[model samples]
Target: MSSALPPASSGQPPVAASPLQPVTAGILTALVGFGSTFAVVLQGLAAVGASPAQAASGLMAVCLAMGVLGLGLSLALRMPISVAWSTPGAALMAATGAVQGGFAAATGAFILAGGLIALAGFWKPLGRMAAAIPPALASAMLAGVLLKLCLSPFTAVAVAPVPALAVIVTFLVVGRFFRLWAVPAAVAVAIGLTLAGPGSAGFDTAALALPKPVFVMPAFTLEAAVGLALPLFLVTMASQNIPGLAVLSAFGFRPAAGPLFRATGLGSMVIAPFGGVTVNLAAITAALAAGPDADPEPARRWIAGVTAGVAYLGLGLLALAAAAGFGASPPLLIQAAAGLALIGAFGASIAGALKEEADRPAALVTFLFTASGLSVAGIGPAFWGLVAGVAVMTLHGRLGRLTHP
Candidate 1:
């Protein structure tokens, strides 16, 4: 025993390892990312008029694109830069409902949005313009867009009390004790209930199949381009990529924004014909890999992103199963799970929006208008929220300067 437990010469205690290893953190990040939002993505696609097959293809395409881009960018920059399908953009698509030319037109809009994102990298002015958006307003708009989804837990409970309540309760309990595992755990409960509860048709594991690409030839129209593409690009940049970059910077990794944007844009373009929406830098999930828990050495944390990418690829292969399960389950169950998953994000966005007192009023206006689900000239509330918020802030600033001067 004495020989086996060699006593330390020094009086100092030995250092303990981190609770989370890089690989474990990576796997957790992937699970949280995909588990939390995949249902919402499916709903969003359906809202925009994607058929079952098309939606399944979109899910697979997005998963693969995000995986490949996440891996490539993380390796290239040697930074834990994770890419994701734009969750906010998907939400916007859902809110916007079916467009003029149907899902094909929506696909065209996706391509245009991706192209604009790529252009932002090449054009300094455009990038600067996106950057110039007031942080408070941007966060407000994001919060507003998420408001409806965040409320779905309650609504789901009303619709299907037993299953939805089970998911909700599980999420709350798990989130309190093990925050990261909340969504995945809730998802597990939902799946369990779906398979075991009365009137349930047991899940057929054998039915799991590899996702196949289904091309939707894009039909671009000015309405789709203006109504869908522009707003999608804006929200994806303002709400997602910018915050994702900020998260990296916070962790002392200064990845080049231009190249990262370009990479995601290119990935989105490649997947667009196959029903993928915009691929972007991940804000929420990026934190999981970029933080100290992933690895003490900043340089080594890129491995976490690579691991997450591999996880995403595996999930992509199983997209057909997920699509089928979600498609067959009660919509309320999916909504409840998604709403619970978004609670943290919703809270963060609201806090961010209201942090500065001077910007509070403008931020509130933005949030209200966006949450109101207003549409003008076929354009959705997100664009209007941005416009209104900026206008209010601008006017307030000008008036204050005049008064003070």
Candidate 2:
């Protein structure tokens, strides 16, 4: 009897057929990207004073923005350029909590951040300013912002042991076997636990209602612009856009960064009224669409990028369901899921922050100050953290020069 199996399937890992390869990779990219950090987005919006409806709208809007922009960029550039919501920015918002003017003011800050991002794309000085920020300080700030949420898993265990442990255990086991699926698996377990609880019947009804945009007129305040907008733009640039470009470079797809930044920044501005905070190039998930796994030939990998965009659009349709499910769960439980998702990022940030012994003192100051939750003169810890680090570095530099001279 003759077998119809492809030769590779007999022993080696089964290779997807050429046409299906990009599609499969794209779908996986969307699933991993969306499933991993969406809770962080919703939590961030809520912390920044968004009502449940507004938070859901923000989620839906960002999904759509990334979907549209990712597709456009990929098709135009013919490179696997994936887009994503800024996970670090979301965490920063969560850490910052509600500003003076509430969600409306936060919306204004989002607009400001969007404008800055767009400017960075076109204005050389603005882009150079962001690049001038020390890598150690930036990473330290990110790690500090993530510290609170990353502790949620443990705190959650104290609050609700059974569900928290279940999520953590699933995360560890799945991570050991299939690393990319780990966070999603933990999310699934948490959702199951949440919906299985009493009073979860309301989620079914809530899920049926489609997501709708909730427009908030922008109301800018000095506090919000300094505290929320600046930090958000810096974090998005350092953590998302820069790394995203590097990922593309690693894959040998060298599309100009300026156009991509402008696209995502403009997309963010368009969606801000609808409650979307920010969107940018995908860093971690870019690998899924740009890597060799997407296709044997680099030239054809844009198909995966395009497919990922379509998948994001489809995911946007389910925003209401996702919001409802997370909303139905206990805040800590949902936070635990979000925390687990951020572990890898936190680890990376910590490693980067501490890599250079020369810069370690400044990085340490940034991390501690940012993690202290300090708010002076209505500015957030993030801004202060950066300031403190810069001050320390400058003073250290002057002292060293004086001594040497």
Candidate 3:
């Protein structure tokens, strides 16, 4: 943070911005070239009804798009604020789809959810309140919220030894050895394993073909709106966006909530037509792209995020690639890998909720309700849990005020 650029006569020092070197910024973009958008593209297709072919097309499309976008955006913003399709958002799509309607209906629901986020982002007080949320509780809630995703790999590994063991071990070892690029290292291993299938031929290319959206016009029944829209909105905001902002800030970058929301919203809106319904700021991926390790200098890492965003935009374009490559994944592997990733997030969230002596009770209430796995008329348990916790605390605070005052 040197001010050498400012002349003495100016009396104010010029802010010494970070340099945009290839290793500093470009390396991060390359790491996420597949590590991020690719994983998400897989998860997303699985959520919708995309077959193996559709998945590949979608994967190829999204990957190239995301990479190009990441490069351009990172360079443009000179900030490392990255964005990706929300993994949780995709999970929500899958979960809700299981309980409800078709992909088009889900896309409608997805856009509705994004609008709500846009609303939240635009409101000054809401943004501040979201920001003011006790950092620890925010973190704890995030950890608690994501715990399930991190543990999913065990089930996969238990059933299929070769692939699961290969992915998990590589990720761990590479992560341990090459701290900056461990996840990518692991992903490369997974790709290699996929290519060199246990005994048979790997990656059947005929399956990797162009993906055209099977246009299922949405029929928005009250059931669809109630069951789907409400829950998607809640999880994307509470479980994902809230923590995303915090992560960005923690890494010394400002959370540009408005642009972040609008851009994701717009992206979701864009691909909504082609069976690519939902997209949002990626939480774990954001953590990966925004961390100080993404670049040596805290300030320079903003370019990393920008790089990720650009990558996402690219992913949006290659519908065929996305379709072709999105479905070769083992369900159990996805569940395990995602579950394991979220374990720490879940723990930290619960810890944050209860970290303060005064907030311990509230945290407990939140944890229990969230863990209850209840769905009220289709809304996830989180909304209800938040309400119950906040309501009880408000009541308690009011009663105490009457007695003391």
Candidate 4:
């Protein structure tokens, strides 16, 4: 593993430069880049019965809202930060609604949660406290969260071997030559095959349409908000922003903690009232935008994120349909592409954790706990790993003190 690099704000801070010109082309390219995430969103809608029109409309709403916010805020902050609806949160809500009421109330819950985020961001102390978490813990949490998504492609291969293999092979080929457009190229191959026949195999060419927002008046209920808000915060922090910070730091961008949290907080507030839940800084996508492929000129990568945002706006209307769409197939192609795309990131995370010898045990524990696929008392592995690692470390240190004395 490479020696751990200092945090973005740790080393010499770059002379803050003027914002790069918006790269419309790169932005346009990135939307096509994250095609799989879009697919997953569609699949979630399908799970929710997300219906045809509502699915379409909700997806468009999510895409557009996220995209617009991502572009505007990213540009405003002069950071390559991107935005996306919380995938983990959406899954939670989809499951929640299935047993609870419906999406409408859940969306209402979404709004309340956004308010909580804004509160967290508004108070600088809380944000700083969050940032103070040990680097290894944060990295482990991120790796564990993403490892699940990274490994999911193999399952896809089982369902649709031929198509998945094709996608993987194509991705590897494009990765060798095209470099910048590698994963995108793989996705193109997958989309091409799917449209060739069977499931959603028809090419329906229609120019994209903008989303019409539906405002759900905030009905403040402690029951709804209490149930929904904490979970939203947890998903955003653990699944969304934490990884985002990891990506930012990985690519040598300074982790400007305050503004990033503030932006997510505010963004969540805007869309939560309308039906968008779990909006947060898009760490995974931001890595895609900030890295070499985002743009030849690193300065222009924010535009890639911006372009993704615009695509989000365009697709926001079909939110549920989008999730269903991804889940619709054996999803071999999506899995293949997403896995190949994240390979670089996964490597980086593992490398990051292994750097400090003292940190290795904790990191390994985290990775195992996360990859173990264990859930206890209704919480995921992230919390559990942290609990175990920290407990062990504290006890070991105390025992050493006692022995020395």
Off by over 4 Å in 4: 1-21, 25-29, 40-58, 74-116, 195-259, 273-277, 282-312, 315-324, 327-329, 398-405
Model 1 / residue 370 / CA error / Å: 1.6
User: TM-score-based ranking, best first?
Assistant: 2, 1, 3, 4
Give each prediction's root-mean-square deviation over alpha carbons: 5.4, 5.2, 5.9, 7.1
For candidate 1, lDDT tens digit of each residue in 244-335? 99888888888888998888887888898888989999999988898877876676788899888888888898777777777664556776
Collision count of model 1: 0
Per-residue lDDT of candidate 2, residues 1-405 (tens digit): 211122344666755557889999999999999999999999999999998899899999999998999898999999998999999999999999999999999999998999899999988778877867888889999999999999999998987888899999999999999999999999988888888876565457757677988899989999999999999999999999999998888878888878887888889999998899799999999999998888877788999999999999999988888888888846667889999999999999999999988888989999999999999878899999999988887877832432244
Q: Lowest lDDT 10-mer window, candidate 2?
A: 1-10
lDDT of 2 at 368: 100
Candidate 1 residue 216 C-alpha distance from true site, Å:
0.7
Error of 2 at 328 (Å): 1.0
TM-score (C-alpha) between model 1 and the true structure: 0.90
How well does candidate 1 score on lDDT at residue 270? 82
Tell me the spans in candidate 1 whose CA falls farther than 4 Å from its real position.
1-20, 195-206, 398-405
Model 3 stretches astray by more than 4 angstroms: 1-24, 33-41, 48-78, 94-97, 125-145, 161-163, 188-202, 207-216, 221-228, 238-256, 277-326, 395-405
lDDT of 4 by residue, 1-405 (tens): 221232256567655423433455435444643453544444444443444444555566566667777778767765577777776555434333331344555556666666656666778765544545555655565566557566655766787778777878787787788665666777668667765646663544331343345555555544445444554565567556777778777766675666666766776767655555557777555666666545445656666666667666654544443444344444556555656665665677677767777667877786677556555544445556656655654555632332234
Candidate 3 residue-pair clash tally: 68
Alpha carbon deviation, residue 317, candidate 3 (Å): 7.2
Cα lDDT for residue 219, model 3?
A: 43
How many angstroms is residue 309 displaced in model 3 relative to the true structure, after the best TM-score fit?
Answer: 4.8
